[model samples]
Target chain A: MKPAAFKYIAAESLAQALALKAEYGDEAKWLAGGQSLVPAMNLRVAQPAVLIDLNPIEGMAGLTVKEKPTSEPHALVIKAMTRYRTLERSAEIATHCPLLHETMPHVAHPQIRNRGTLGGNLAHADPASELPAVMMVLNAKFKAQSVRGERWIAARDFFYTLFTTALAADELLTEIAIPLQPDTPTARTRTCFMEIARRRGDYAMMGVAASVTLDANGVCTDAQLGYLNAGDTPILATQAAQSLVGQSISAAQIQAAAAIARDEVQPPGNVHATVAFQRHLATVLTKRTLTTILDFRF
Target chain B: MLCKDFSLRFEMTDVTQKRCFVLFVIKMSQTTCPPKLLQIQNLKSKIPMSDLHTITATVNGKSYTRTIESRMLLSDFIRHELGLTGTHVGCEYGVCGACTILYDNHPTRSCLTLAVQANGHRLETVEGLAVSPTQLHPLQQAFHEAHGLQCGYCTPGILMTMKAFLAENPHPSEAEVREALSGNLCRCTGYQHIVDAVLNVKDEG
Candidate 1:
């Protein structure tokens, strides 16, 4: 369980970290929280020759909520190294992005969350992880910086397949920006996060992040169901979501959408769950999540 | 996780076929991996043995500086480097909470953390809990009274984790206490007595 030998450099600034990434390229890895990376290193699954520690970089870890102008949607900026514990207790998140606030506790245990970062979890793009699904449903954007320049990758375009992402070798995920519901009384948005795990802190067998916006007449204007462990990447049930739009969130609509969601996924089976069971979970979670959203009297 | 798709439905009737399957597993773990990985490892990179990093941190309120390999785990630094063996190691991966310690007053898994990452940070291990052998910490005394431990192996970690847990929530309900203990795993005891021990601590102090 010992990690392979490597040169560690605690980058003092963002510029230094980017320069180090450019220098080492594929041979180096930017260490954020080290909750996932170190475990892989200990298993000898990931063996990068150089580890550029980004913790020491100033202004790299924080959370901020920006209330936009009257017509613009509000935004939440979370720096890459901002730990999960911080997000768990953030009042701003609870008020703005309720789905993310609810999903925080399901990421991992308190011990792992104390060291795990939001950016690290998203960039990892694990099929079984919860944050990626949350990010996808919330319409978040990731900022990737390198020696060349910085670029913004949309949440939909960020994750490619499996553990792979659109991130380049020399790029470092700087921060994540999630759009929040507009601060208007008429803008009705409800979100729910739920997962079924054998143990409390174990990796979930199936998880869902569901969000819905209703018009003044209680008709669904938009809907999204982001699922983890359901496909090669974070599966955004587009067809399922489209079925909900323009219809009242009744038992029929919810069941129809859930069925579509169950069929849209290509869930891989494991010892804990079979392909049939995972599909069943997807259907049940989707219906329950949408049912919960319907109960919210907006 | 990368090898989740590797099907084991092949017939293993011969040794040659079994050997080929083992080699394929190794290849999936190391060497050329699937296209899912961001880093394409075609060239085998050398592990730099001589590159040592200096870490200056306060462990259990005592200042210490050590130059060691950057890949050295924080749990090993506490046990081997600082000679604080009270911190136990179960699963080196972050799943088991046996290597839990307080990093900057937050209960953190030292196994998943690198020693070099602890530079200029504050770490509290299990050895720092008691003042002496005769006078155990109040929580430890409560455990001794309530029979919280059986094998006594996962005690240090559970105590360290609860030390921070109780600090955050001084008066927690039984369900809340169980939720806080979700990270720490105990094999021998069914956690009924361990939960009793933690609840007993709140009554005394």
Candidate 2:
């Protein structure tokens, strides 16, 4: 199928791109990797009058990891246009954010990852996408810019609903900043991401990302549990996370957290999975992710 | 001529002043301009039209320049424009990877990409996998020896995808081979022969 005829403009600079977006407003769409947008256009589900191509813009495709200084927290900054292939192979990401490195391969297949952009995936805001859950668990922040100015939104607040984000019509997601795990011998942080997809590259019926920080006495100090395909937005198990924060990571604690998460999530029934099945998967994945992070058997 | 001078003045004013001047011109032109010119201006103001784009890309080791509609699919450009039919189009959606090709040395779905987006880029289709007219690439030869094809439709795409995969990972395990081929789906031969063919080629080295 062929797409509807549309005007294309290769954006030369960030300012020009922002101006074009401001001029065209809702009639224009920003072209990132185009893995999702192009296909949607071909299917005639999405037709925009103007496409501002962001591929040619400079300073929008790299990764930078800043280690913690005297009083500052460690941070991992990823430019919006950075490809998934780059993130999958980036040593900087592996060193700074190991959880993302482990979760990268689970994102579609290698071919799709080669062309898919980090910003595109986030902005697409698919309920089943892996990056949103990962970002939610890691407490990442997104920098959105327009001709007016720039502002940062937390990962929890950035994702508003299904296929929608806090981004305005004229705003572009410029960067993703994830705070890295602190280097503390007394309290060690462990993270894990897991999902169950029917096929290798297919979207997961359910996925979970869990991060836990344990103090010296083997008691949990901090915990974050995020689920994909759990609801309209990436669902965060705040009540479940609080339940595990003061207790040691044990089978009973994991089960309690998993049960709370399974009860809190309300996934819609799709052709591939029913609501009950998705809820069951949420429980299973939560347990698996927490166990993997805790390195405890069953 | 009077309208032309008025538009020149409209263009030279500041933004706030220009907005008022443009509204004034439109109101004045509605009464003075001919019906046909007024109709044309009305159509232009209400609707946006697509324009042809000139794109230059190196496909199969040869550079070509073509003017295409902005919405033309790259898979169609490879087949209809450049006359390379090896890259097959299956589902037209990103799900089916039969239209896969090497875009700048990375296996990308040609069906999902716009032809204009491939401008100033390098692409390798199924036609480029052969070393010569009579000679076949090692993977192609292995497919032949191992009976990797029954319908021969998805072979070109699988070959291109695997070529990029093997270049990155010269020695991949059987599990890794299956993982790499997860994107490309082959209905014929049950994929056992295909896996065997790749294993045969890996064993050759």
Candidate 3:
């Protein structure tokens, strides 16, 4: 199928891209990897009068790791246009955010990853997408820029609804900043990402991401559990995460937390899975992820 | 299909213009006409042109420049315009990887990529995989010996995808080959032969 006719503009710089976006307003759509946008356009689900291609904008595709002092937290900064393939293969990402590294292969097929951008995936904000849950678990910050100015939105606040975001029409998602887990020899941090899809590369029926910091005594000091396809947006299981903190990871505690997560999530039924089945999957995935991260079998 | 529809619409517009011209001539000879008639003529003349983009890319080691509609897919450009039909398009959507090609050495789905977006880039289609019209690449030879294809429709894309995958992983295991080929679907053969073919090549080395 052919896409509807639209004016195409290749932006040479970020300033020019922003200016073009401001000029075209809502009628213009930004083209990152075009993995999702082009398909939607072809299906006539999305029709923009103009397309602002961001591939030509220099210095917009890369990953940078910032190691701060012991008092300050380290961060992994990724440009908006950095492709998923880069993140999957980057040793820097593996060292800084191993959870993301482990989760990269589950995003889609390698062909899609070759062209799919990190910002595009986040901006698309599909409820079933893996990156959103990973970002939520990692406490990533998104930087949105407009001709007016720039502002930072937490990953939790950035995703508003299915295929919708807190991003303004003219604002471009410029960068993603993920705070790296604290490196402490005495206290170890472990993260795990897991999902179940009908097919290997298909969208997840339900996904879970968990990050836990355990002290020398094996007591949990910090925990974050995020679920994809749990609701309209990536959901943070706050009650479950809180239950894990101040306690050593145990099979009973994991089961209790997972039960709470299952009760807390309100997911809708789809052709792939029923609402009850999704809730059950959420509990199972939560238990599996927590146990996997703790390196314990239950 | 959209191209056919566009041409049909253009022919219908031509017929309508001819009929309008005849009516306008008749009215001019009979009496003064309303301003609406002249406005219609002006509007007909002002029919906007379709949005077009000029792209320059190196396809199969040769540089070419072409002006195409902004929405023209790279698969169509390679198959219809460039006359390189080796890259088969199974599903126009990204789901089917039959249109896989090497975009700047990375396996990409040509159907999902716009020709305009490929401007100033390098592309290697299925046509470029062989050394010549007669000689086959090592992967193709392996496929031939292993009978990796049945209908042969999905072979081009599979070869392209595997070529890139094998370049990254010279000696991939059976499970790795299956994982690498997860994107491309083949209906004719259950894919055991294809996996065997890739493994055969690895074994040959």
The candidate scoring highest on DockQ is 1
Cα error, residue B198 of model 3, in Å, equals 0.7
Task: Give model 2's docking category.
Answer: incorrect
* Model 1 lDDT per residue over B1-205, tens place: 2223321121112232110111212213343445323342443356555678788999989999999888789999999999999899987877768999999999999999998888999999888999897899999998999999999888888999999999989888999889888888888899989999999998876
Q: In model 1, what is the error at residue B16, expressed in angstroms? A: 30
Candidate 1 local Cα displacement, residue A247, angstroms: 0.7
DockQ for model 2 equals 0.20
Q: What is the TM-score of each candidate against the true structure?
A: 0.92, 0.90, 0.89
Question: Where does model 2 exceed 4 Å of error?
Answer: A296-298, B1-49
Instruction: DockQ winner between 1 and 3, please give it.
Output: 1
Residue A128 shift from truth in candidate 3, angstroms: 0.6
lDDT of 1 at A266: 83
| Per-residue alpha-carbon lDDT of candidate 1 for residues A174-268, written as tens digits (9 for 90 to 100) | 98999988535555889999999877867777899999998878888899999988876889999999999988878998999999999998887
